[model samples]
Target: MDPILLTDKESSGAFWPVDGDSSLIFLGTGCSSAVPNARCLLQPSSPPCEVCMKSLSLPPEKNKNYRCNTSLLIDYCHGNRERSYILIDVGKTFREQVLRWFTYHQIPRVDSVILTHEHADAVLGLDDIRTVQPYSPTNDIEPTPVYLTQFAMESVAIKFPYLVNKNFKEGQEIRRVSQLDWRIIEGNSETPFASSGLQFIPLPVMHGEDYVCLGFLFGKRSRVAYISDVSRFPMSTEYVISKSGAGQLDLLILDTLYKNKPHNTHLCFPQTLDAVKRISPKRALLIGMTHEFDHDRDNKILAEWSEREGIWVQLAHDGLKISIDL
Candidate 1:
């Protein structure tokens, strides 16, 4: 089918494109420490975890059980040409994840990056973006655009001062300098933002006691909400979802770190199930999994639970892709 460009009007009557051939690829689906922990591999417990052992034994391409730090890639196309390659988080494993999934030949450039929070697992790879700067289709030699909340932006600046500083006097190679166009998102606001011709509404959700992480809702007609590291959904987020008028989403990617144990900052399986009930998405996929659960076993349980609950829910694995029709 031909890719259709979706156009919608803002409150001020300004029209923008919202429709396109969009596909979301799960670049990584593991927690901050990632799966198959080195510590776990070194010391063997009683009946060492078969999943982790197997993952270590096989190569990355052959191991479906291995995982990287959670992140996402939103690829959008208009007609025959690609429009946007929006990345969610660039964590410690960003380089390896990109090399594994995104080939140099297919996607030579990344249009933009949307940071969710300031955690090391979410923003540590900001500097590596320089690798794609030269391949930018615009050929302006300008910095690549990076969207983040005020808190996240500040945290990034503190972590990577060189990236934000335009007047660094150190003589360095052009490629070594961080080329980034920082865009700060306002606090406590659901203002819609545009990146690489795609529109996104920043849905603020709680991330433990001190952090407010931003999950994004993309596309107008068929929305896909990606909340990889959220602990709880804020009321304003629900209101925004309701106001969107779909009453349900095409896809909902949420954090499901543990099966029974709940963390102070991450959602457990039960909380993820509750979230699915609230959002009522057509399809739900759980991300940010730890090493405690094996992919095959956990997925079997999830499949059974999904059938019982009458909702389509599955565990998201690295490299999983889902196309959204808008």
Candidate 2:
């Protein structure tokens, strides 16, 4: 069933049928500086950025050019008919994305969260999770579990000290904040960990020459890997994701920031294509795009490329959802 077609009441809490079908939803698919860029709109020149202009010309619901921070939601349904909503990245634009996509999909709550890195666009929405996990006077609500590397944890501690320590001044005691349970993953650990009954292997990749970021390979019957902020992949990392030349991944969600040129901290279009070929996944969805790409135009290029390579590849936009076997 298409969640998009469901009425608000029909899609509400526990409304998704317990049919054992799991799916992946793109909550946001743009890079840190999301589409409809402020600069493009604020500046007036002879030639305007077509993508940014289009974002303003259409309703957000009808506009594929409209994008927020990069994030994904995995709706994992278990054998027992229970469901788990796993969120990847709570970015700066998290609240906006949630208001639109979560409400649209009728996602009741987030069961857990996984961080790809500590970048502002990746983790700044940590506090807004309170919207999903309401506080109970009797403290019945469990804190939402968040998984991240020690490095990321350290960064979070520094950025949101109150979140880590739960220390608030007397004046702020009445303020409601997100109830979060922090779980640390060992840096660079490749061993798989379990969440919502599925296994996830952390694939460490280079975000920059010195900074290490994590991607994840997850699922049971079908494997999916997500690496939203990677610039380079180590040989070991590549071997693990590709099954050491077996190319076992069913779906690969990767970063592709610019359309043509190289980027220092992100994969450019060519680099993304190169990585897609190297990993040789059965299918690929590009993410973390910038205003440089017009969704319809760029996807046409990907279509031709995919036809030639036999491995499907296309850009993922906010609110896009695809069912997957888990």
Candidate 3:
């Protein structure tokens, strides 16, 4: 397949295509509540948030500050003629995101999906996979494979019982369930999984007191690590990331939810900065921002910080795409 540039109004000159390489697209960059929160809009505070105010004023087409739930799309060439797409975390806005960013008619189907955790923002869009099953690129009618931890799988079954139970009572209509083949991942394990001709290593991290969230490392030559949500990382996981290429990383997408204050479950600005220093990636892009952050203003802050710290860092906006050759 030849290199094709994917562009939209917000990302017109920002994206460049590269052949025989892998590309990562940030479909959404908001937290669980999402930017322009309904409650925030309904109940105005003393000093209204300029970011939210600006987002409300601009039209949808021109607004770059409006964010949806966080998700990533990994694309790579499978062979001479086929292109493969692997989605990471299908959140609440998954359907709208695909509709807005992808030429759905041109693409055949998604290769696979990997879930990060059991959070509603991460797994609620599982049902939407049914839409793409009929258009399987490989012409296989088999179920779509979804990989997640054992705990996450159980949570899915509980949340969407209808999808798992195939036996229906008499006279009950057979609902068209999402064809899914669930794969269980063991905890605290770094297993190498293959999809769409690319290899990924699941890196486990701490998401609070009880939850364990996953991050992923893709490719061997042009290594990219994506950890969209994380409060802390275990020492072993840190070793695995730092062990690669003397701790040099081609790209690192991390979580930075707040500007100054820290959250128990998400990384704030100070924590994210410390993480960038420790990991020492060649380029770092911050994701999982809330409405409290103004894209243009916060980005300027990041630029100055990057210069002072001598590390490349920036904020990830919706529809942001980065290509890396392996």
Candidate 4:
């Protein structure tokens, strides 16, 4: 049987599920270097960054432990019983992350993909999603909807050239993936695609020093907002998400790339909180942690910090799944 979800109303732009609702799930919660210097950089000799140090100072979730970045597995069940889903973001440890989540419970198949940016921690694991296709044998065939802004698509193309073949045409417009000049593949056959029940809303966010990044507003509003790579939310983005807050917030997954020192690109905890207050979603979760963060400590402190603010905050672990109301 499908999991229990809240349902009754109908509308986009709110976190409150429709009267006949659906769901979403978390995949990972680490920074680009999900493993810290000791792992990815192969610089086990280097010291942990200040953010990681502060992370180690907090209490651990004591339940699940994901190294860094995390995403959601969303299932948007409409009032009429139509079901469609989206893969919010894929992380570095994504392969490991999904395997763990599957071990505990069966989840709705990942239908499409929504990206925050092109950072390794978020996009590298994307290759693993190829495996998802084979698992959901009943769904119709379509190129996985990889939703992102024009700028983000450019970054991914440069980084993962093979994924989006220079000759492929169907994927050019998946989610405003730039670098698509007219006539790139003039003679190639058009491979058409569409997501089952997922709508892609591309949100442009400010990252660092003049570089704007893509933060996706999943399921339009009521379901979830996966904004992990942003340092600050642009007015346009705030406007888009503000629209989603009209309903009760199920989950507001956001960036927490820094603990104290503000970053040139992602948000520090304080900035993230400020945005949360304005958005005023029912729940909020922080993601994009660095290796310096010891899952054993920071979570406790972060939770305490969240409480003082009177906001419901939780540290994202490697394999945690949050079933949202509609």
Candidate 5:
């Protein structure tokens, strides 16, 4: 779908391809370092998205700067076609993650959005879903399902009241945009409902001081697990994750916030790698990292350390995509 065009100014050539379906694209991947500037001590020499870096030449405090939080969009499709899709998390960069991302591909719709927690960084961009919920082909109506835990609901309701549409009834439809719903990760209650196509089993991992973030296991393709903003994996977390087919994993998208001795609870790069080994997830890639990491430099170090050491490891970035034959 790459259509070549003549760019008389920059290069005389540019390709505008009709972005196909079934591609897993990275919107952003930093813990809280979404919008980095001189204040971000962590990334003294981090890489910036080409487009974003281009504007750095302009005077700061006057330029229209945009920041983003950590989030992931898993597009399930083969070749130029896609069947279903799911949004892992909607961080503060919700709007920018879309605007910044829209520059590349056009996301016409979303099946559902699964929030990891209620942190402002993770859920702030939620309100923007309004734009994606009006293209439903089912029931001749656009419906976007929001899945979250009871704890998240309590926090989100207070933050996003407009999304609640307080005036609507249970079965009523509002402009074809479906309201949010509650999902039970652990319990024995005939609650609202859940989806297996997501292949996500709950892993209550610790985050910050007293907060807990949800770690999900993407089950459709190969055994892939996603856990960001977590310190240690609970025994229950391990048990439930092992249930994703055969107590084995193919890919584990983990958090590598820090890289040293430790912090409050988040896993440093070294600690994260070790966890991957213990979990025995054949292959694991670091996520939710800061610009502090030099993708090429650090990745080489990790590759040398774990290449043939019975496990595979690598660093992730915005716009990077991976495909598993499972």
Candidate 6:
């Protein structure tokens, strides 16, 4: 398949793509704190964060300064002409994101969900899933399928006991909550798993020195690897995403928390570029940005870097959608 690039104008059409093409939609593209930080707006620093100030002036749809938690939606189009919406990371801003992009894209419901970790920014919005669950004529709740690592599932069980057990008081059953069918990704992290008729290979990477988070390699012909939050990749995982590895990726979405300086739990811009160079994907988009970055300015820097390095890399913004061959 040839490299697929959809201009912003080309992607601003109807909700669904052509019958044969799959699309990757960025639901949000900011770190846990998100862009337009509250402190910047409320507290007001010496000069105020430029991005956050700009965010207040422009409409969200027109503002690249406004970003929510890092999340993605895969509109998977099968050969049978059927479509499935597979979402990654139901974060703290899930509801707002749904209200904005989901409504904009006319996505009726989510077919499945994939979790990267148990962090609040990644899982706090689990409760919002009830809104998008398929309707049941009999009034019985239809559970949404969710896949995550065993460790992540354990954390979720602890954090959301009601969601896990569902044993409520006699009259409390009337109180609606998210009904989830949790499926843990057991055994080896490198092994592949199936969800909504699509295959995904887990890429286990370090969140810090002690904690691990999952990234994924998915799709058929136009393969995409996504790692929204990661400090570093293990040697084994690095080998998998490396250019010399067995399979090459068409797109790589990675973490870029800050413009400079290293952090303990997330990749800064320079490290992100280093990883992109090693992975050698045909195209790359950096996500998980902070209020420090002006999206347009940073994206221009990325474009220049791409020209110099010959690896097409850029910053991903909320609501940006790309059509890919699958």
**Candidate 5 local lDDT, 1-326, one digit each (tens):** 33111112111111212233344556666767553533543344365443245225444222222234667777666343445557877876766766655444566666778888888878877767655665453324544667788788878778877566457578965454334544535421123234425455666787875777887765555667778778877666766455343477766788887556577768888788778777877666677765456555676777676755666676666655444442
Better of 4 and 5 by lDDT: 5
What TM-score does model 2 achieve against the real structure? 0.91
Question: What TM-score does prediction 1 earn?
Answer: 0.86
Best by TM-score: 6
Off by over 4 Å in 4: 1-21, 36-63, 80-82, 135-142, 158-162, 166-195, 219-223, 242-250, 292-307
Clashing pairs in 5: 22-77, 92-121, 136-142
Clash count per candidate: 2, 0, 0, 36, 3, 0
Instruction: Give stretches of model 2 more than 4 Å off.
Output: 1-20, 137-140, 167-174, 243-246
Q: Which residue runs of candidate 3 sit more than 4 Å off their true CA positions?
A: 1-20, 59-62, 79-81, 103-108, 135-140, 243-246
lDDT of 1 by residue, 1-326 (tens): 22112133212232333334667777899999888877778897889877678767866545557889999988877556756788899999888887877762256678899888889999998877867667544334777899988877777889998788766367843435547899987644447888888888888888896778888888776767888888887777866554244367766889988778989899998888887877777667789988876776776777677667776677777776555654
In candidate 6, stretches whose alpha carbon ends up further than 4 angstroms from where it belongs are 1-20, 135-139, 168-172, 187-189
Report the poorest 10 consecutive residues by lDDT, candidate 2. 6-15
Model 5 scores a C-alpha lDDT of: 0.61
Cα displacement (Å) at residue 171, model 2: 8.8
If both were scored by TM-score, which would come out higher, candidate 3 or candidate 5?
A: 3
Please provide, for model 3 over 63-127, each residue's C-alpha lDDT reduced to its tens digit, 9 standing for 90 to 100: 55778889988777654746777888988887777775554224456778888898998989888
TM-score: model 5 vs. ground truth: 0.74
For each candidate, what TM-score against the reference? 0.86, 0.91, 0.87, 0.68, 0.74, 0.92
